[model samples]
Target chain A: MAVTGMQAELTLGPIPFHWSREEKRDFYARIADEAPVATVYLGEVICSKRAPFFETEIPETAERLERGGKRVVLSSLAEVMLTRERKATADLADMDGVEIEINNAAGLLARAGRPHRVGPFMNAYNEDAIAWLARGGATHVCLPAELPGEAIAVAARAAAALGVEVEYQVFGRAPLAVSARCYHARAHGRTKDNCQFVCEEDADGMPLATRDGRPFLRVNGIQTLSESYVCLVGEAGALAKAGVGHLRLMPQAVDMVGVARAFRDCLDGRKDPAEAEAELVGLCPGTRFSNGFYHGVAGYRKIAADAAAMADR
Target chain B: MTQAELVCPAGTPAALRTAVDAGADAVYCGFRNATNARNFPGLNFTPEELAEAVAYAHRGGAKVLLALNTYPPAGKTALWREAAETGARLGVDAFIVADMGVADHVARTHPGTRLHLSVQAAASSPEAIRYYCESFGVRRVVLPRILTIPEIRAIRKEIPCEIETFVFGNHGLMVEGRCSLTNYVTGQSTNMDGVCSPASDVEYVRSADGSMSSCLGGVTIDRFAPDEKAGYPTICKGRYLAPHRAEGYYAFEEPVSLNLARMLPELVAAGVHAFKIEGRQRSKSYVRSVVSAFRRAVDDIRAGVAPDLADLVALTEGQKETQGAFRTKKWR
Candidate 1:
């Protein structure tokens, strides 16, 4: 069995950076109203501390998304779980009707006694892990950002056979790592315990540089993301051919609605991928684009020929 | 009750020889490929060179573990598989693997070849370690450096594998083998590619007032005063701004050393089988000096002598060392 895009699906990936409660509420409200996404994921996927500010805002936000005709899925924290974190994950699992995206093994176990969607953070690289998740009641699984196209195809086939929807990150900076030490905390002369909500200052995260003055990475509290925007606009055909079922675009600070529309147009065959790529590239600030990870190359390498070939197809 | 083995890191063949000669019970090195986490230029052994190095170490009564720990890129299993096969053929002690796929491949193809789980696997709990042991026949696990002595003792009681703990060199609290923080900016991952903030991407620029800013791939990692020593330019170890603070500070960990030289007896008592020294990127002389010091310490501990840990200060990070997360959890 192989997956196919029977439904033109768009999943709003969890916000990778911290924002004010008002900002988060407004962001989701806009996504529910203006975006073309079919599903929206809410909750902190980066830092566990940032969850408190928005904890009360989630139910109303989930209701907003549901009212706007989008499916809402709450995400679990990604790394460095403590007892409190384990309890929070369990609480998320107990939420009725709101689908939970299991990001860590703890979350997987918490949501195991019931049906849920596995988030991108969990490593589902092989058939065995995928089958395990399937048996444990995972209805959908987002593939890891580092997986190339061939592996995606294999996993997509396997997920389809198991009757689970497969999703991939189509836009936004790919989440690279989750850490115990908050980079945001360290940057501000504080430890993770006293981070003082410093990460909220960088709406899109603080840009990190290599020693030689290269724009290398971004530090968003405990979460780290790739500097390059993982553009899959060019890989729509390969992904479609590979039987990918849905595209997940992470919410960025600016022009996100336009980014969503561009992806929507491209996925629906209403726009050329090259045109979509050009539009999406123009929308971002001070960032380059790459999809080399999909083709099994250095992630920053923008293979124009590959993009052009995918476009030609 | 054997003396805890001293496992050292060797980035080059010279370092390999230096480590073995300095009395390391085992030295771990990587092939000059993505198979190892330190895939920097001018480091790691070539396949031909690794065979010779392994033979030299084995003849010297020391073991060599080949690190083939990076995750295999999709449809590109051959490179990792080749590294595993080459390590086995060269009679290396073990294949240090982080990826489950590579571990499975090595275990299936080289049945008798020993397999040690890399810390990059981030198996911190007993259940996590037990999963590896039950599934892949993992003989040992280089545990992540975040656990305290009590936590280590607790996990040791439950897992089936021998626990190898880091005793010296650089320390990180981030989830090992799973961290892509380096890849977020530089397009290289220490886990997937075995390279983090690749040296080619690093640049140090002097600022006015005798201060300097270290950059990795064009982003400022940390700025330092002229009198202050510059640390390595990885993203997590950098200084940044936060509220309730006057200026940028080390957000993750400060430039510190992991010197468990003083805690050898405690670690051994906690059921650790091996003490690992973690600087594969250092000089051969550094390897010789560190391994020699730790070797005496371990031997003296085994012979019921109090280990002298004073000489280790000069080799530590920032000329300061801490027992790190090994002794206490509150260090955070």
Candidate 2:
């Protein structure tokens, strides 16, 4: 059932970048005090080597967010390759009084029979997979970023029928792939084990450019992300109408609180879609925005909402 | 010590026969459709071809593993289901699957059928492997090409099912089944359509300065000098410039093939049950040479003798090879 006004919830996804412990704490502190998102996902979803740096700060951050009337969920790694990572995932599953989001299958195995959320990294492409995950105690599922609009609508409908909430990534650089070999270390001519944690230097990520000088992708240690940010402020109403329960906003090195407000204004119909797009561009200046994956085109192509509307007419 | 089975690729009936004749313990092939990962045109077997291949492998005491590994799109799962049913009817030795729905279908509908989890599932941990073993009765899991021998040994001790690792062919450093870089450029995805950098959209351009470049979907992926060997235009192996770096380099991975011929003994000693060779789209002669070389290496290890390392650098992608995360976790 689609409500008339602001029915879809705004969720802040876990930070995929390698931010320092203090920086992470400060970001969440700002988010808790200011951002209008309903849920805040915490914990390291990228490299496990960076986990201990912020291990002590996770609880405090989650507590602060909960105190701010926001629901907190601990997110697991997108890829579990080492033994310690597996143990850490199992430990996350064993935690009490906190919801968990399983990004990989190891999390599902560790947290089976318990209500949890499935992150975008775990493939929930088809209805059968969605129903299977729901039966295994998944309360929420985020569709992958590459899914077209029609597939998203179908998956959202399937989730509704299975009594599961469906979430979609609406902002930031889409995480394309993750690997065990650290690209940041490789780019710096260091190995993953002795890399000296070089990824911390790049707050957002190491921007990769094509040979011809076009910015193509960002190498964030083990994860590769798009150079363009996925902005769907204009599609919030259509997404909500298609039964999407939440729009996940990925963290970037920008004014995320302002970004959240822009999305909220657009979703609530307080700002015109075109104006919201312009405001988003102004907020994150010099960032390329794309929603072509949602439009069944190349992911880098930015299809203007006004142009689409006029074409339909 | 149990000799690790040699699992080889077979894109056609001829390749299947060559692999079996060359001493592959099991040959994996897929039907001619998007239901399988190697869904390229002029590749893969039809149902009748698969039935004959299965029979031929059975006669030679080799196994036929049907690969139905692609993730079916939402509301379009009947194709995968039909693939599984057809594979079962043709008496495939096992069904290699990646999607949970396909695994569930094979496990429920075809009871007593052997299920091997494809590497596309990206299950690396003991908990993840055990979960599949517990839920779908998966007998084997093709491990992602991202783990070291020591890590695989640790996992083998903890999980319940058998382990399979790639010993040769394309080093897909990116996490399998989770990558969308190809889809971002080409609108077709490996998970959804079993295609990555589809041949239809690939282009090779020769510059006037005696240099060549490979392009995928009109985006230049990599440039090679006349003296250098150019590789397939996969996005991961592309050379790119970064702000932190001055010159262009492979930001993700270099164009190299995984050659674990020297690490076969260690992998076998680590309790790995199978060694997979990655190229189903290759020619029959390529299959024969690789399968035969690995077969001798596996046999030599089992016989307590050193494996005579065959020179396969010429057959490698970009004429380069690496151990690739098997000897160490730091190979980028």
Candidate 3:
């Protein structure tokens, strides 16, 4: 089944949860020492309220990752609403010493004409956007998780033509929305300002269920994520063939190092996709795996393969 | 000239006419496709209808702005470009755009066409608004509903372009252009597909107990008592259950409409250039009633009279309204 010669690299996405400083420090240390990821993104991509806690640890973590021979990109907030958030985005854009990835429209102006990465939150959905961002110094782009495999293939091709690298999240709970209001704080009968770091209690984010008692989503401060982790292990062959140069694995509470190794094994043809899928299920025992968004179906469903892609092949 | 111009929505030609006759300075409508946000069936105008609508609005001494806001999907941007060109050719006053590519194309191709940055761009900060203004010569920006009055005042001092604020209609609590809660449960996307909890996929089941449950796709968003009014199943306004609250609660936001009817003077004092009303999918009578009421309110404020707007509450979602985020940090 592994008939392609092209190999895809793996990237570690930023943590979407609010973990303690020691927890974050230990995670980064392990990643620097043991994980097989090529690039690591560090930042508070969700809520501005959670930024103050771990913002100081970013420089140190980036340095540690750099020592481990990994490319480090500092990501700006996915939603830049507050005045202080805008200032922080501008300040990060002005820093030329480190590579930066901008997620919001606020960072686009200052970061223009210089090299930077584009996060999925920017919604790089079409070719024209990819081409436009390329002109504005976007050397790399992590396409949004909602895009199907066919759409991603089209975007990857457009990005490849511009010499821009494309990264797709192949694992981790997909981020569905970012709101100005914090659901996590609201659940505890508290506002975001007085959240009291309530989100820190659930290291993997608080579980949210539908009215029918079906577990559907995870609430992490202002961000709403899918209950099912996006697992595109089955599509690894097609993804590599589609010119997707890098596969992203978002940071979760699971054994991410093992998860990275498994995906790397499948992409590198060292392990069968089914074998890797089994390993993923073992590593993330609490959640189900879904490839629905990749198959042009509901993001919560677990479709096996793209029938349209199979027909085309 | 009045202190601020009022921009109203027109889902159809009749609504367009209704908005103008009700004292709207400008009316915004979209083509019947994914090029705009409210791309529902039986809503929006066709190209020919738009030409007629523009002519009719101009005859009534009002400007018509065409919304081409939704982000075009990968490998399929031509539809959006053609829509923009057709709107420009039809003599629409301005184009409300969200995606940078569409804005870029409009700026370079139709050099003098006025561009208003849609709230779908989610550019809430002054720097973000400035980026759009400087990059594409955007004349105005529909500020996201996530800002406070003071925050809006602070932004007004920094940006180079005119700012438009929503004074009535849906309490859009989510940061626009970025939220994807609808996409997870339903296959349709608000950003790319231009539909959120699309009507085709929504179902309401009545319980044997005379209560009702609203479902988006196969998942239930909220349950209602027999006497409670059922609203559209917007994912953000849905009730959900968590460990902290065994009983379900409105985790993101409740089903309430944003009515800034009482705060007109303060918004005008903040140097707002336009007041926006956000019901593109509403009925003709709704357009007539709401627009006329707001019309009187705007005029009353100008005449230095206190406007009585209590009657407008009967038209809000859940028959309830909120001055969300504008009054205070509802959820700091």
Candidate 4:
């Protein structure tokens, strides 16, 4: 848990979109074989209706990643409303040989007395809350993506003191909110119960634009994500210095292995942070990039490094 | 019929007296600080005002619930701790809290005080609700504005805490306490600053073509036609363009108020212990009229008669109201 002299581990966060089961299998197959991530988070973290489609393939995916020398973790849904969702989360607690990442409090209650990771959606914003979760057997916690750097440092220090590892989202679209109503289904002129799984049509998620035609967010079933990918490749050193023990890269419909490599290289000091940022941009064409949330500005605003450095001073 | 308690919003000392006079079983208010969600300028109660308001509500045989609901920023939880300590010292009936740190502080420091989980906590499932009840001794949970009545009935059977539902006011479609869209656009968030679409950052401009546009943080959130009435510039309620849609539509939710006055008996039968109203920044007349209407509705339900729900449109947002997700599962 010591911040200094500790190499930050690169982790692939759970996929939040709805892709085909075969596509998911192929994606994980490539990730396991080629990605340089130290840990892999699998399972559905969005709507429960989408879980059954991929549930059968999870064990194989986990096994393949484990064979590739990666630690596999299963993530619970962010919002658990249906009874079946609750049951599925409780069932995950009994799964052997893998840790669980709890996005909802229901998962925490079900996995009582067991070591687990608290996902970003659980809202551990302060030191006291992080300590509380650590007391409840949480070994790691991914702080919310909207937090600024100072807050992250404070929480990271508290977690480090409690012997808990703190992870921060460094790539992919930041998940901003989750709701009971499925916006994707509603957009398709269907109800959530009988929508026929139309979210599968958009691999990255359906883009939401402002009235002026500015891409503002992406709608994936019940969750809303920032339109721009949150790229902290430029701040790897700063984040590590802030005591962040892990850098999480959420999976998207891009060259994820390349994305993982860029982050891995940047964190390992094998490549310059600016060069890694350029490589990431080239990997995901036509997507905006942002690191403003870390600078305590609007999430969509990308502050220039020199300006950010001056502000830090 | 079982009687469900009516919880009304008291934004100020005057509003507290007005709600109590109009027959509120309990009034919920917040200190004038960032600790509460309705942290608007010229609204909420000062510490002295809150102390006086609690005394006034207690004198009228009603309870006061102080909302310390906003998540405290890191390394600055003293504000929330002070609010809880002040509320406990002033003899408030319960503390409506959202953050785990605030809840833990209140539970540990003021063990005798009741803790009601705010809707902002978004505890939708029984396991999540029970976690709060078991972990922090939360006595009741203001259920999120999402669950259907059947879902509430199922949840009530599973958890050991009282259930509270929003009976009237803002129909927030987004998950409470989790949304950072405001911050994404305006660099301020309800979870951190207790303000969503802060009024100072809102702008309404009348274009030369006779159309109107509502803007937030310099971004045009929605546009209104010459014949259409403009709504407040909340990020969630605005119309937005999406793929495969020609025109902009309400991607999240429209500007509609939630009016569940007709479902009182059904909610009571579903084991709802309290019905909460959602406006703390509304006028004193709003506090009085809405609280009085629900008060009579509850009484009429107990008397085995149909409750009247007319003349509420004038007070609704955008002058439109819906039952929201209370009676249906297809609200999206």
Candidate 5:
């Protein structure tokens, strides 16, 4: 790969991990100043109860991100429909100067006849659903993390035909699911009502190991994520060829800006995807990277085969 | 009003017959695929078995609902579509689906076949329920276990579809159809792949303190003492360690059963159309006993008699049960 003008648009996905109000504000404030990401998704996507903590800071943070030259989008709760939660999401949809991302169909109902981005939580598996959302005023759609490349390519073509930007999770541990119950709290021996906000203790997420004692997953509050961070650095070429417009890197506890910059560098041809993977490893030590899901294999297969080769050596 | 419908889960034809004989109004089963949430191996029905089960249910005057509740994996959608077509051809009373794609497919391809939105769809709100009714013609929405009675009443007013609430069995606290924690650790999604913390990935190891730890996909989801009874290895109900807590505990949900038999009247009063009992993988004796008890309770309610809520206690998870979200938001 040679240096060129290619640019990998970075999207900051909604923070899946729960944090205190101050911690969340501080994270976004730092992201506003430092992250090379393009969009900042603000909302509590996991449990509806956590929304009250930082719901007030969302507008200010969206403004701050906008002020920092980043496009900011307020996201609807992925699992909406509770009375208070629905009202909260409705109020968020009513927020001004902020584009909204419809994580669930509730967003479509809330933002009826308004433009919004379709969040990855909504299943847009085929062109029909993608086109349906687009017709319903979706300008951008982040494809689900579980989608293989074939589906992505088809979705990209559909999105392009409808003049919508298609995004993929190019980094971070993929958010696998959101639940009404808090896994972390239950793990901590508490029910969701009395969870004591145990999720705040883990900055990134609590790493989960397989029965054989291998790291396989991470549980953060009600949301569960893959243990291995999905590194699409090696798939940049394939992504570009597939017409994916934006690469989303979920915000982690560490150097997200550097991670974004590395992806940017790789996309710009200043470094190889291999170089980007090396930097990603150095930036987030002890983390494993995999892109096997993109190639329609296991989610934990690393595209950079040399690391596995290195282990053999 | 007619006596409330007693919806039961049938893991096999024998269980279906057992439930029907025990006073089940309708029996629900799933084809052996990711389309249904109970994709447990050796469970569920094959095409021939499902055809046989449907015939048996109909002959016995019990309606059969085929579950195609899991989200269809991308690019492998034909499997779900085929399941839907086969279900319709077999003359199932309805198709219980969770995914929008699967629902859409069934609604369009088999217009005469009734569609019930699976709880796995997570359509918990009136607005969401309305969307399903309008878009895919969802006839009934199986309410997730996280709703209060008031929430159910509110939904009743907003949607045109009938509401089915879970009254017994596994009282899951998580949003249905959307959870992936099990798949993250076990390489299978409960909603899409229909397996959660699959047995192949589960391990039971004896700890140093004479306690046994239950592991899922090589990770300790929870542990129990030598005298303590361990629940099945599902990640959500597993105990984990946190910084503030010294002892590892239940990290997802308390190991409990959703035995809302006591709240039957309240749910029926709240415009609920049916009551569901959850355990399909259970033994036939368990099904016969639970179904008969609920049947008596429901009959008592119809006859204006206050039924005693004992005897069912033995079937409760950990010998304990709660009304769950039907009581209060604070009920844990």
Candidate 6:
């Protein structure tokens, strides 16, 4: 598994949480100065109302990351339901220079024939979807994490023929779902329109525990995410073998710089994957690890590597 | 205004006939495989069943639309392709597709065929709808359960294809074709597997306190009191503990059904070409009642008569309903 000559490029996905302008600038500033990531995605991929809060900081942040020698990709809202959201996507689509990562079909349609990246929200499940996206000027695709490794390999093979880059998320809480209604605001007894930015309270995500009092999921604004962070450091070699060129790390509340360093070490074969996994558990305190979606099991369930590796085959 | 088409769901061949005989203008059904959205056990039509279904629907002046709406896995598109080819051969009226790959295959192989975009595609904007129409020559698109009447009207003015909207049954607040909440807890996906919180993994337990609890993959989704009605533990509709509430909260949504009978006139005026009732996972009776209720309502709207949709609450989940995001954003 450690034998693949292809070094996995680590990319930072957009921060899903509703972080303040100062916190986001500081985070990106540190990411620029310290992180080992090759690419960084910026923009509001969740609620459109949150876009104004940090829209001004995106260019400055993108310039900062670019100055740090990382490619910057601007992302669109995942659920483009409102009229304002549609306008925002059209505006983003009209922008030139930086590549846009389309999360919703509205963005994809708006940016037709333009070089862009397909975010995981687009649901490129199979080779056919990849081919379709590639034909529509998609240069790269971050596949839905619900897909198993074999599926990824098959998609990668299809994508390889079409000359499209494939990205697999190796870290962070897998974004499970996006709804029209804001669950974060709903939980706080408010509506999507008048929620008063209550989502800012949960920097990581609001935990959604089961009736039995077990943490099952997390809510960040309108999105529902898996409770466990997808820690695929143990399977980086397996993913690379599956023709995955880039391994994406979603920006979590954890120390992403250290997280990237540990994955970079594992991918470079300097540190064992198991050691990196252990290192990540220590680095991100109070976080549970899961890689079951990689193994074709319940995404929140962490399976043993022997079973996981076998399942990938 | 002209009477809009009354679209209905058909989980089985019986449901198809029931909806047609009960006055559905169009009936949508999927194969018994994952190619369709409602891939539940003991539901959906076989290829042979689809042939008879087409014949029956055609005889009754109702159309049969095949729902090839689920995404096929990489290296596993044969099923979806075969389903579309088979449906085309069976003389089905149209193919309701979600995945672009499936849409591409349908457009190329079955030329001059009707293609309706499934809500599972989650194409919420006019530009997105136009993209599908331009790329695949889509005839219609089932609008996702997210937009308001104004948004729908505004979207209608921009796209070339006809617009269909959900009027009754399960209110999926989560955008279809993109949701993976069930996949996280059960490894079963709505977009891929066409099953959410799949029946195979579902369990119900009763406690000594005369309370009932529903779980999926051994994780408790929701609990019910002795006299409280327990709805199916569709993960999004279930209750969960959040710091905002000590007892619990319906973080995503409560177990409420979307009954937009009151908004039919507005929807029709908003340029809705079809009104879809979503309950293929439900029984034939549910199909019959919902389709007929909506049928009369659509007719009443056309006749300038107020609809009598009060009895519809009996057919809803937990016998509770809401206008959802269609009436107001405050429902969010």
Scanning candidate 3 chain B in windows of ten residues, the lowest lDDT window is B310-319
Candidate 5 on B1-332: residue-level lDDT in tens?
53478899898888998999888889999987787888887788889998888888888789999998877655667889889889989999999987777777788899999999998878878777777787789899998887889888888888898989999988775677666566555556575588777887878899787888788766677778899997787766766554443455554557777788778888878888899999878889989999999888887777888777675655574566778778886643
User: On a 0 to 1 TM-score scale, where does candidate 2 land against the true structure?
Assistant: 0.96
Task: Quote the positional error of residue A18 for candidate 2 in Å.
Answer: 1.4
Residue range with the least summed lDDT across 10 consecutive positions in model 6 chain A: A1-10
Tens digits of per-residue lDDT for model 6 on B194-274? 988888998989999999999988889999999988777889888899987879767777777888887888898999999
TM-score of the first chain alone, every candidate: 0.94, 0.97, 0.95, 0.97, 0.92, 0.97
Candidate 2 docks with a DockQ of 0.73
Docking class of 3: medium
Question: How do the residues B114-144 of candidate 1 rate in per-residue lDDT, one tens digit apiece?
Answer: 9999888776656456657876799999988
Per-residue accuracy of model 4 over B245-295 as CA lDDT, tens digit each: 759999888788898876778898999999998888888987888888778
Local accuracy of candidate 5 as per-residue lDDT tens digits, A43-114: 888778888888888778888888899988787888776677778767776666678887776556667657
Per-model CA lDDT versus the true structure: 0.78, 0.88, 0.87, 0.88, 0.78, 0.88
- Tell me how far the alpha carbon of residue B319 in candidate 4 is from the true structure, in angstroms, after superposition: 2.4
* CAPRI-style docking class of model 4 based on DockQ: medium
Candidate 5: Cα lDDT at B257: 78
Query: Local error of candidate 5 at B1, Å?
Result: 4.8
User: Could you give me the TM-score of model 3 versus the true structure?
Assistant: 0.96
Query: iRMSD (Å) of candidate 2?
Result: 1.2
Estimate, for each residue in B90-123, the C-alpha lDDT of model 2 and write its tens digit.
Answer: 9999999999888888999998789999999999
- DockQ, per model, reads 0.26, 0.73, 0.76, 0.79, 0.37, 0.82
Cα-lDDT of candidate 2: 0.88
- Each model's RMSD to truth, in Å? 4.5, 1.9, 2.1, 1.6, 3.9, 1.8
